[model samples]
Target: MKLPDPPTEKSFPSPLHHPRTATMIGRWLGIAVVICFLTGLFSHFQQQTPSWLDIPTRPASLYRVTQGLHVLTGTVSVPLLLAKLWTVYPKLFAKLPWPPSRKALGTVLERLSILVLVAAMALELFIGFLNTLQWYPWPFPFKETHYALAWIIIGALLVHLAVKLPLITAHWRATPADRTPIATHPESLPPAITGLTRRGLFRTVVGAGTLVGIASIGQSVPAFGPIAVLAPRRPNVGPQGLPVNRTAKDAGVTAVDADWRFTVQGPQELSYSLEELRALPQSRSNLPIACVEGWSQGARWEGIRVRDLLELCGAPKGARLRVVSMEKGGFYATSELPPQFASDPLTLLALKLNGDDLDLDHGFPARIIAPNRPGVLQTKWVHRLEVLA
Candidate 1:
């Protein structure tokens, strides 16, 4: 008897499995991806600023806005990614080309790129959202893994765009073919009942993205604080009227005694008691403490100008500083303040926040508060400022 023919899979009909739909969703997703990538890059550099970069101290709220956008774009992308995946889910079941041809190899490679893109992006978004919540159950280091995966995702996305350029171009101005109401499908409820169409589906996807954004953005935008129920932090609800990322207790800090002193060692080593620091000419800055986790608050900070301290200690003009903190065993025990930041009049060893003495939880005694710097680099409970040329 002749060998039986192999079974063939039948195509499932759905109103969403159209190129027009995928293109529409993909465009929105692309915009989100670009925004997240650029803002994330800015945040990374703010944390690890290079010697050549002269990040400005003006506007003061620049870091706050960029970091906030980073988190917002990342969060909104979640819904867009899912909806894009669903629109093209049928493609996942497509069979590989047989008989080992060159065309088949190309097809396989394209599919492999898509796999990498999907996996990396999905994991990046998941880890990023978890990071905001201060939950880390993953074995890998969150920062390194997140950074590496970003490059991989971008690479895969570029490859995907190149491969689908023709399709994208064709659909860019093509009339909306799937304009038929979603109710026409046999399984779908009638338009009279569901009142949804392909256009409506697109609107619904955008709406989902907006809803998630609104619910979580209150962490960064104090105006929406009451509705930021889904956010991990309320910008105004924390120790000393600001959200605290790493507390003194968590940093293994014990109660500082009367012997505590703030020192600035340069060409001339100088030390001051808390009272002496208060006696020094104090300047005030309206600055925002912006964290990488997307929470920030504007505060009135009172402190001695970093420039004045440098001059008082007889440090060379435009000298860099190594800010050392009492907190133990972390990468941020000491942070380098570039010459520009060290000399900026706005840069301060803040002693008071919101007109009150610095709360230990908010970097008691003294803390570094420089413009356009990541909160992590704002060394808390500072005890020493070693002029590092």
Candidate 2:
């Protein structure tokens, strides 16, 4: 006996289900994906610091801008992704070829790619946004999984682009037919009745992306801080007027006693007491402590410049250094300072923040402050600087 045929889906007309619409929305979404991916790559490299990759130390604000853009672009893509999915919802119901032919197998693979792309991209944005809140409710390792999924999403996206390239090219630059009636039936709602033409739908999607961006971007953009209510953090709303990723107590760091000393190990191994450090000539730099969590705040920092200390210790002008922190049992307990960062005039062993002695949580006594470096690499509660080269 022959098996019965499967039931077919009833096709419904969605005014926004046109190829031109998907093309237009996809162009912007593609741009967002590229920005998010590249910025994410930069961030991963910053944390991993492969031997072959040479990260720059100039302008001191390069990392700040790239990371801020990374988060902002990722957040805004949420709306774009939703709109793109909505536009292509009809495709989910498109009939698959029967009898398991070669063409049918290819169709299955293409659909599989779309499934992977959507799932990975959606999860990526979700976890990334949650991470900025410092919340981890997932079972897997956040960093490793996030990194791996990024590659999977990109790969699936490439496959999807290859499948959709014909359609994208056909409608990418075509003029919208505003007067075209969507349906002839009297009861059927057309663009004129719904007041949602192709142009109107495109504008609506763009508006959604813009709104999400403006609402959340303030966490990274200082100008938008007051209105970044949608973001997980307020730049100046944390303890001592700046958000804390890790506390001294949590890092197992306790208050130092009178015997506590700060040292520079080089040709001349020099050590200084708290009072002696305070007596040394102090320099000031207005720098922002930008975190990977997507929050940042600008503060006035005063201390001996790293280059100055290197000079005092008889270290070479462009030597790299290993900055050691008092905090224990953390990946950031010590960080490497590249030659350019070590020599920057603005890079300081910050002893003061906002005109007051450093808060214990904020790396009191001394901390590294270099332009454009991540907060984690700033090496808070610093006790030693060893010239590496």
Candidate 3:
């Protein structure tokens, strides 16, 4: 049997490049980009400002998450941006009188602004991704470069939009969603399905899926991959050999039916209390708890890395990890580290702080101590570990 004929060029117009869709996407992306830029700037100021200015101590984990989101959105925007640019490319080369008339000058300025915006977007996304992967190629700090470029990009975008006001207005007037289909054939496409049509649905679905993939995989997946594979063993160094604060009665936080109880759970499984967790291989480290907040402290951390604990429990790889407090309402904070951190010697399910038994306020019983990361991501008072696949 023969397969159905492929869609004809005439039957399927180049695929609708809906002005409404483009505008909506661009507007939302523009807002997101602005937010990313502002947050980055604020984070920088928080670090640089003197104490007299009384800036709040920004948490290291907060910066990591915001920065992560910023980079993720920027990377995801790459394709959407390219598509928008292609859809508008025809206007770039449209015939114009060469004598520098007002219209010609205006068009020239708009195009130049677009060129700069595109270039800036490319540079920022590329550098941001590298930074996340722990690669810094340029002499300038990534934060500095990113901050400077952000202003330029935003300024150019504003100018470009202002100059294109007339065209944007015309497009809006021509294709209000209530009056017309949401998408139409690409100018390059054959004349079939002339007005906004079902093709728009396809683009929307594809674009939404792409956005989800970028957000989820870019931010969460890599960090949650199998811990054993990435961080096979604990790091030799820990919080600078800080003295343990615990009493002789609770060495290694092994005491049962006390202020602390270790909680370990595999993905989709019941959790174990502190005594149960002590049965696993034991490791200890003294490392620095560095914070992006401009404060650094050293402490000795003891316990198994969450990775080893999870592996012992037969937990699946790349699960969303959560740590809860043992207190009432289980008041807790969370940090999502890649599985690699789990196996790293520096990554500890710490039961002690400053060489003492776990402090109640400082995540007593058990907390996570991850090297080269902010304290907030450390998740203190760990009463539960929920593995989300």
**TM-score against native, each model:** 0.94, 0.93, 0.49
In the range 1-389, model 3's lDDT, one tens digit per residue, is 99986443234333344455456456656766776677666555544544454332234244445544554465556665665665555455455559888988877777778889889977886776566545788888776787788889889888878976766666553343424443343443433344544345436645763654444442222333223121111212233322222222232223336544455566445556666666667678765554332223445677777777677667777544666644343112444555555555567787765557665545556778765454445665566776655
List runs of model 2 lying over 4 Å from the truth: 1-10, 178-190
Q: Scored by Cα lDDT, where does model 3 land?
A: 0.56
Query: What is the overall TM-score of model 3 with all chains considered together?
Result: 0.49
What digit string (tens of lDDT, one per residue) describes model 1 on residues 1-389?
99975433225466667778889999999999998899898888877777776788776788899999999999999999999998888788788899889999999999999999999999999999999998999999999999889999999999999999999888776464556665545776776576456787888999999999999999889999889977999989987789898899988787888988888889998999999999999999888889999988888899999999999989998899999999988988899998889999999999999999999999998999988888999899999999988
| Cα-lDDT of candidate 1 | 0.89
Model 2 compared with the native: what TM-score? 0.93
Which numbered prediction scores highest in TM-score against the true structure? 1
- Inter-residue clash pairs, candidate 1: none
